[model samples]
Target: MNSLSNQSRVTYSGTGRRKSSIARVRLIPGSGKLIINGLPGESYLQFSPNYLRISYAPLRTLGLSTEYDIHVKTKGGGLTGQADAIRLGIARALCNINPENRSTLKSEGYLTRDPRVKERRKYGLRKARKAPQYSKR
Candidate 1:
């Protein structure tokens, strides 16, 4: 049975993006382990319950939160972007595992790549849309 078990070890990968963040995620058949950038998921996302929830939303939706292991490498943006990117990555990977998951994930908006990003700073503006204090004299 060892050979049979070995044959069942499948790995799936997907790329996800949110704002300026990008994440490369992999899913492997294992017991619900999550590793992010060489650290455990919870540790990496410490003090942010919302971020942790976003990262695991897809798996929880499919009732597979404890069926597969997730490994992620992400960069750019802030904690929220990274978490959202990871969530999308996991959803895409799940679709790769079974195409039937596509509709469900799509309906729940997990497979959709959030298109909103940081706006560019105009040449004369102090920020994206804020200008320096006006001089009316």
Candidate 2:
């Protein structure tokens, strides 16, 4: 039972970003649970199946979804970006637990930080790329 004590205390952490969102994730050995910003993951994520799936995709890929609990603090961007960030963060933390997991995570593209972001609106444009209606007269 002494060995279990040491294992219980081990924690893996990672950071992930997507668009304007950032997620700091920690993986701990426990029954699968997700806590985000101190709130239950399901409620915080509005119980959306897609969001939950995205957040757990990494663990599911490794067949360890129920072996670890995920704790994350994420901010910025919309839910979509936050969910994606959580996915990446979980993947990275999994890699930290076992380097061999890196290859599988990478192959699934979960380790890639999405670079897309909102473009700054130009001074003369209505939005990032929209401009005044063209006048051919």
Candidate 3:
């Protein structure tokens, strides 16, 4: 059995932010297993499955064939936000793994944080852009 200490590896750290959430991730070469806050798959399921899939999609799409074990600690956001943060962390880590691939990753816009978000609702409004009941009377 291969022990973690015995393996030759490079460590990469990245911070991802989305909405009110932030995710910190560490990537190291190993078998593909995502460890979020020291817990494995079970912990990941705490978040929405679609978000998890979206977050991990980049790794495969980018052709990062090297097996990696990812450790992520995310806080302060909803499931969607956390997923986006996770995606950003993975993209950054991939770039660290290979500087030459920066162009590829950058072109995909994985490095940029999505700036769009919900606007604050006004006191009299039901939602950000929605107005209160209009009366002709």
Candidate 4:
């Protein structure tokens, strides 16, 4: 049998963001595996199965779920935001491997970075838009 060292190693990387969260993702040729923040995807996101689906949607879209291994480092925001960010990051890394995939990924809306963010509170308002109780006497 041949040694594993005989194969060349290559990695693709990309960054993705949503709201206040950001994710850095790397892709390497190997059996399907996803590691996020040093934890397996299923384990880290077990609390929400939807998040697991969201994070892997890109690969599934391109029928590449089993062709590459994914590694992600994410910070900020909540689990949902982080999951979305990782999805975009993976899409981007796939695009890096083949520019032709951009159109397909874009069509699926995976390549777009979500621009929604929390609104800042106003000095006079209770929140971004909520006003204090009006009183008339």
Candidate 5:
């Protein structure tokens, strides 16, 4: 029917944000294969598996399975931060595909970007303010 045809034709592009990182993602119907800046899926192995999993969890949760191709360009943060950014991008893309699912994704906290990072160490401190080993006899 029209509904089935409409769902199948859905495709989207979205941006993801997490910490100080950002990722631009494009979603297209295809076998599940992730491409990062033109590189193949294997290239992501350079990053931690945990990071990759976090970024891909939303897609799997949607039951999309091997039916969507993701292309992303991410930068401006460490691997973990990049992963979180990518996760946000994918969530947004999915929302675009079907706006009705926004509530579900929102409830899972996928739409919000985490805004926390390590503060810079102050000057003249062993470690952020250790003050070396003080000893006054």
Candidate 6:
């Protein structure tokens, strides 16, 4: 009962990361539905249209927006990072579906991973880049 075996459908998977967030995405043929961490995408994202749009960008680029169901398990960072991670994961899964999808996804810049991350804090610094003021008598 834990897994679906009735359909025997093809499943494609990919992993994405942004900032500190990591997402594992799976694609399966079905009516358009997005599930994240066992919750519906809309509610999980607090019904933010911007977040939904960002996460769905890759599928929209391929014109296969309604043809596949996206299931994601993500952790770390915040919603924005997670959303971008989902986008990259979906793009990769789409490429797994068909190599031809790579050109489209790459041209749309969905295949590129954002390398920016929080810098490590140095000793005597208030934050990663902020430091205590030096006073002159």
- The TM-score measured for candidate 5 stands at 0.77
Number of clashing residue pairs, candidate 5: 0
Query: Which model, 1 or 3, shows the larger lDDT?
Result: 1
lDDT of 4 by residue, 1-137 (tens): 25555456789999999999999999999998999999998888875879989998989988999999999999999898999999999999999999988999999999999899999999999999999999996
Please identify model 6 stretches exceeding 4 Å from their true place: 1-7
lDDT of 6 by residue, 1-137 (tens): 53676557789999999999999999989998999999999999999999999999999888999999999999999999999999999999999999999988898899999999999999899999898998997
Ranking by lDDT: 2, 6, 1, 4, 5, 3
Q: What is the lDDT of residue 35 in candidate 5?
A: 90
Model 2 per-residue lDDT tens digits across residues 83-118 = 999999999999999999999999999998889889
RMSD of each: 2.6, 3.0, 3.8, 2.8, 5.3, 2.2
What is the C-alpha local distance difference test score of candidate 3? Answer: 0.80
85, model 5: CA deviation in Å?
0.9
Judged by whole-model lDDT over C-alpha atoms, candidate 1 comes out at: 0.94
Give the per-residue lDDT digits (tens) of candidate 1, residues 14-116.
9999999999999998899889999999999985889988999999999999999999999999898999999999999999999999999999999999899
Instruction: Summarize candidate 5's per-residue lDDT along 1-137 as a digit string, tens digits.
Output: 98998888756888988778889998899998889878874476375677778878888778885879998988887777878888899999999999976888888889887878666688878666667777797
TM-score of 6: 0.94
Per-residue lDDT for 1-137 in model 3, tens only?
46775565677888889998899988887887888867784466575678768677668777663578888998887878888898898888888878876787788888898987768888878898798789999
Q: Pick the candidate with the highest TM-score.
A: 6
Root-mean-square deviation of Cα positions for candidate 2 versus the true structure, in angstroms: 3.0
Any runs in candidate 3 off by more than 4 Å, and if so which? 1-9, 46-49
Prediction 4 TM-score vs. true:
0.92
- Lowest lDDT block of 10, candidate 1: 44-53
After TM-score superposition, the amount by which residue 84's alpha carbon in candidate 4 deviates from its true location, in angstroms, is: 0.6
